[model samples]
Target: MSRRSSKIEFVGSQGVPLVARLDLPEGTPWAYAVFAPCFTCGKDWLAAARICRGLAERGIAVLSVDFTGIGESGGDFADSTFSSDVDDLVRAADHLRENFAAPSLLIGHSLGGAAVLAAAHRIPETAAVATIGAPAEPEHVVHTFGGRREEIERNGEAEVSLGGRVLHIRREFLDDISAQPQAERIRRLRHALLVLHSPSDETVGVENAQRILDAAGHPKSFVAIDGADHLLTDRADARYVATLLAAWAGRYARGSVPAGPA
Candidate 1:
């Protein structure tokens, strides 16, 4: 079935308007999901757009959001922290609950993936959680800061190049990531988990995925994306992830009887 896409605006953690895209199926959807984009990436990122489209085509309405200070969202990237990102996810889920349906599934890409893992407990309605190229801990993203860490530490903030765009990096952002209790959250997560990572991904190593799986409880499964990159830049790879995720989530998110992996 074909899908419809619409632009949406919702208040974020900091009470600023955050822009998003809602992809809906042609008919009533079996479930609703929230998709969080990669670090420093927006809702319209190629992978996010394609995955939302793919899920919508399979009868799931997907809402992909731009976190505060990124994409069309209103806020300063330098003022946001990893904890705020998790709060933003909660706000996004609240928006969904008020307007349409509560999100039964939460999907995140890269750092966004880690955010979902941390935020899942706050959204009691979430039945399934999925991560693509997510790190085991929030601090894993510090590697991207590279040489700028010293500069940010010494000067409070620094403008660094990320994905060809310059963004402000703050010492508070680094401290927040380092202080997150992500592992503790994962150990107690009540929702089912699906971890998708590419074995060859050069960005967030595959070992991160292993650590996440190890920390999560039962009803969790892992899928290696094989030849995909960290971003799942290839349209085919992104679509494959969406398709598999939709199917896997069906067992939990669709209000059907839960079934263990074969």
Candidate 2:
């Protein structure tokens, strides 16, 4: 495994010890970014780590973390809800603010994208938001939890499968998913936005990207990530995302900052 440059342990609002990796360009001052992974995925997931490292190699410091109940974080997956996920993101941003500099960018994949969209309003330090293969609606995730929903509600917990892995789903978690439409929340975001999606993405069809684009305000851009899947499994696809992100972000108003590291 390729080790990340900086590994940090931080506690979420729920007291979960979230694990994260930070990559920074030498001498880069203050500029920072935060990455949120998709549902049932962790910081070490293939394309995510590659993209994070690529962004970090550039002047921007990048942080990618495992949410409260996932990966190396200290919590049970069954007990986690979308609200908790947002809380975790806020905690990570706060960590960057208190220890390093405020994060200027928010990058999210799939469900992570929705979580970032929901968190953007609260994180005043974020100048821009980006999403790749994101579902416009939060309930879309429930399709993956089928057959287990009733059991979860009845038994208080149920073991469900996702991304070729089994996880526990709890009733409270389901209730959280039922609370609101993620697309509506995203439409209210005030920050500059970027939406990237591949027409070939089998997991999250391109339609979701269109919905997000339609809902967001101006200063938003859309790019088709040709030949990429929901996971961006191929190295070339992941690199493409990194390259496009660096270029697009460079055009942002904050792009005026002097070149740092690459």
Instruction: State which candidate has the highest TM-score.
Output: 1
Judge candidate 1 at residue 47 and give its lDDT. 97
How do the predictions measure up, each by TM-score?
Answer: 0.96, 0.93
lDDT of 1 by residue, 22-51 (tens): 999888788889999999999899999999
Candidate 1, superposed: residue stretches over 4 Å from native: 256-262
1-262 in candidate 2: lDDT tens per residue?
1223778889987887899888776665336788999998999999888898777665667889898777788887766788998888999999998998778899999989888898898888778899999888876788877788789889988889898998878778878878866766777788889999999988888999999999888889999998887899999988889878877776662432444533
For every model shown, the clashing-pair count is 0, 0
The candidate that achieves the highest lDDT relative to the unseen native structure: 1
lDDT of each: 0.91, 0.83
**Lowest summed lDDT window (length 10), candidate 2:** 253-262
TM-score of 2: 0.93
| lDDT for model 1 | 0.91
Clashing pairs in 2: none
